[model samples]
Target: MLGGISIWQLLIVLGIIILVFGTKKLRNVGTDLGGAVKGFKKAVHEDEKDTDKPDADQPQSKVSHDEAGNTYDVQAEEKAKQKAENNDERK
Candidate 1:
């Protein structure tokens, strides 16, 4: 028994399906389903690849310059501030 249904019972259900929606229709439906699944998988993989890549148009630098021409790396400045705060706490 397959899934608690006998082989003959399964065959009868298959026959009914074939009779309702002939062989060609069923084949087309199967092909369309497979294509949809393949497209979904391809889209998912493309998204994953996109996320892994950094955008080419955007700047990668942490440094920024002000209108007066002063330049500084924001990340380094933040780290320095945190270190000072930690030192103050230790005291």
Candidate 2:
């Protein structure tokens, strides 16, 4: 009845899985599944908490400058352009 799956269907699926991955492997699978479910629950709770608070540290603008005299945003753009040009040359 769990997730609309009948008992017989569940048994058949379990049997197939057991045949494919033996008992020891199935135990590992169960542990992995439990870990994944726990992680999912934690993630959902974290998302709810995040939604309740404002993320002040996150920047709204695309460009960020450092204390150095050198302009980093322009330098990054130039580097990306050079990389694209190099890729074009290779092709």
Candidate 3:
């Protein structure tokens, strides 16, 4: 018995796989399989969040820049703009 699989069955399955895809190629198959599984889980989680959220017509938060050109939002757009300006000055 080949690892609890009948010897004949194991040999036939192995032969078919080796013929279709060489041993060297099959070696990295596990990594590819794991990546696909990880991506699937990420997509499922994102879908769940989207479903939980209301429609676009629902009033959502938005950022508006004041007369002074100062931005207000969850993130500091003013700080980001200042950083970009500084970088431009360096160049």
Best candidate (score: lDDT)? 1
- The TM-score ranking, best first, is 1, 3, 2
- Listed per model in order, the count of residue pairs whose N, CA or C atoms clash below 3 Å is 0, 0, 0
Error of 3 at 70 (Å): 4.8
Models sorted by lDDT, best on top: 1, 2, 3
TM-score of each: 0.55, 0.43, 0.47
What is the per-residue lDDT of model 2 for residues 1-91, given as tens digits with 9 covering 90 to 100? Answer: 7999899999999899899999999899899999999999999999888787776557677775566776459888999999999999999
- Candidate 2, TM-score vs. the true structure? 0.43
Error of 3 at 15 (Å): 3.7
Candidate 3 yields a Cα-based lDDT of: 0.86
Candidate 1 RMSD to the real structure: 14.0
Root-mean-square deviation per candidate: 14.0, 10.4, 7.6
Instruction: Give the least accurate 10-residue stretch of model 3, judged by summed lDDT.
Output: 65-74
lDDT of 3 by residue, 61-91 (tens): 7986566855558467788988999999999
